[model samples]
Target: MTAGEALAAAAARLRAAGVDSPARDARILLAHAASVDAARITLIAPEDLSPDIEERFVNLVSLRAVRVPVSHLIGEREFYGRRFKVSRDVLDPRPETETLIETALAAPFGSVLDLGTGSGCILVTLLAERPQAVGTGVDISEAACLQASANAVLHGVEARADLRKSDWFDGVEGRFDLIVSNPPYLSADEMQNVQPELQQHEPRIALTDEADGLSVYRIIARDAARFLSPGGRVMVEIGWTQAQDVCAIFDAAGWQTIRVLQDLGGKDRVIQAQMAEIGN
Candidate 1:
């Protein structure tokens, strides 16, 4: 069949399977299968698709219909204007997490620490944005560290970025002017309600801590002060309804300047706080 015909058939199959944004997903997957830019898809003639391209497109559509994330199917995701390789090994970088990057960049820092660094999107982006800065990213999964390392190299910041296999601060050393995380914050109950794409395809350890979702924040709050330089700040992405609880965790840990920042959607997305200067 032709390219347009194949696209229409795939979109119809996706729509019938109850996939949201079926047409958009189909277009993107088709472009990927056909090895063309998504923008170039519209310019191609209906008869441009070869048999192999048509077969690949049909297989991709079938996988997407089963609720697999398009990013996983494509093996990369765009974050902060750059593409990072993604897989089941790391959480897919979401647009909401960009709020953490924006908040971190608003302040001055010579060094950074990214906990649960997943795909290394946050650490690599920061280092790329600030050429003089160096950063460390740690994850519990070795595969995640590998993925993050690859992304750092892809962004040409591998020299300034260190990816480590650690559970939070376990193997991390040195103080940083800024520490950030988008740890698993979903409660067990919330985990039960997530979309199948995330629930089944994404890493569960990166989605929920199997507790109240505040456990990871509590751990960060209790230990971050020890690893932060004088006047160093900590910023973390949180669940929309978690602003108060997370702020309280940091406040109780003696962090000052605790504040919540909202995303473009006006939902609480980041909680930031600073350590007291050494003299104080």
Candidate 2:
């Protein structure tokens, strides 16, 4: 089969499977199978495909046909203009989460902690961007910690970042100037409504709180004060409708100066709060 032939077959299969933008996905996968860029796929799509290349393309199509996330199939995901390794054990990084990084960067901090730091996208990116910063990323899955560590090395920040396996704050110590997270906040119903690629491919523990969707926030809100220094800040990525509820959690936890920021879509997506001092 030629590249064009492979593309046609993959597109047809993806479309039948109800995957959006079948042609676009087909082109990307084809490029990967052919060892070329997506843009270059267009130029040589009519060219003949080797038997080995055709076999690889077929395997990728099979994976995508079953609703596996394209990023997982590709083995890497781009976040904040950098690529991070991803696995079934970690949540794939999304563009919206990059907003969390930008928000954290806006405030100057020497040390950072990334809670629920699946794939290390936020922590690694933060350490990469802020040279003087040292950070640690904590995740429940050991596999995720390994992947995050590998990505830290890939991004040339391994010396400044530590990846560890912990159930939230269980194994973590020391206070940080800034703490951030993109925790699982999707409600059960929300999980059901998620796209198949995400629902089937991504780790459930990294996507939903497995309860009413407030579990992670509750834990983070209550524990953050202990882990953050006086005047330290915490930023969390939240579901659009979750801003007020999350803010209330922080307030109840005694965190002050609670503020929510909106993403590009005008939805309140990040809630930032400062831990108050004892005297004040």
Candidate 3:
């Protein structure tokens, strides 16, 4: 069948299965199944699709109808204007985490440490954008570490990025000019009601700390001073409601210059703090 005919059929199937934006999703899925860009779909309308490609598109539409996330199906996601491979093993990169990168770049830092760097989006983007900066990304999951390393290579920052396997700071052994993390901070109750797409598809370990949602922050706040050069800063992505509690953690850790930056949605989503003085 022609590409346009396939899109129409896919759209009807999606609508029948209760998927929203059926037409749009159909177009994207069809293009992807054909191994072509979505824009190419419009230009190549009324063209023949191989039997195998048509069958693959039909299968994808069925999956989308069941609410499987498109990123999972596509095996990659675009973040910060670059595409990063993704999987069920990592949390899909969120836009709010870019605030961590922005705040880090603005700070007085030449090197960075990204703890719990799942897909290496923040670390890779930073190294790609800042020619002089080098960074290390640590993750507890070996799979995540490998994925982050792959992203580093994909973005031409492999030489500047060190991907390590560790839980938090357990295996890390040095100081950093800046430390950042978007660690799991979702509380148990919150996870129970998270978006179906997230809860059903994204890795649970990447979404929650499996304890009080703030465990990762507490660990980072308590130990970051040891890894941070004097006056070196740390930026962490937190849950929208976590600003106060996270600030308290930093305060108790003796960090000063604590600041919370909001995302485009005006939600306080990133916390920045500096290590304390020796005498303090």
User: Highest lDDT: which candidate?
Assistant: 1
Off by over 4 Å in 3: 12-24, 276-280
- TM-scores for all candidates: the values are 0.97, 0.94, 0.91
Q: lDDT per residue, candidate 3, 20-60, as tens digits? A: 78898898888789999988898777888899999999899
lDDT of 2 by residue, 1-280 (tens): 7788889989999999999999988888888888888889878977899998899889999988888888887899889999899989899888888778888989799999999888999999999899999998999988889989999999999999978889999989998999899999999888988998778878898989778898999998888878887788889999999988999988888876998898878889899988557222
lDDT of 1 by residue, 42-105 (tens): 8874666888988898899999999999999999999999999999999999999999999999
Model 1 residue pairs with clashes = none
**What TM-score would you give candidate 3 relative to the actual structure?**
0.91
lDDT of 1: 0.92
| Clash tally for model 1 | 0
Per-candidate Cα lDDT values, in order, are 0.92, 0.88, 0.88
Worst-scoring 10-residue span by lDDT in model 3? 271-280
Worst 10 residues of 2 by lDDT: 271-280
Clash count list over all predictions: 0, 0, 0
Highest TM-score: give the candidate number: 1
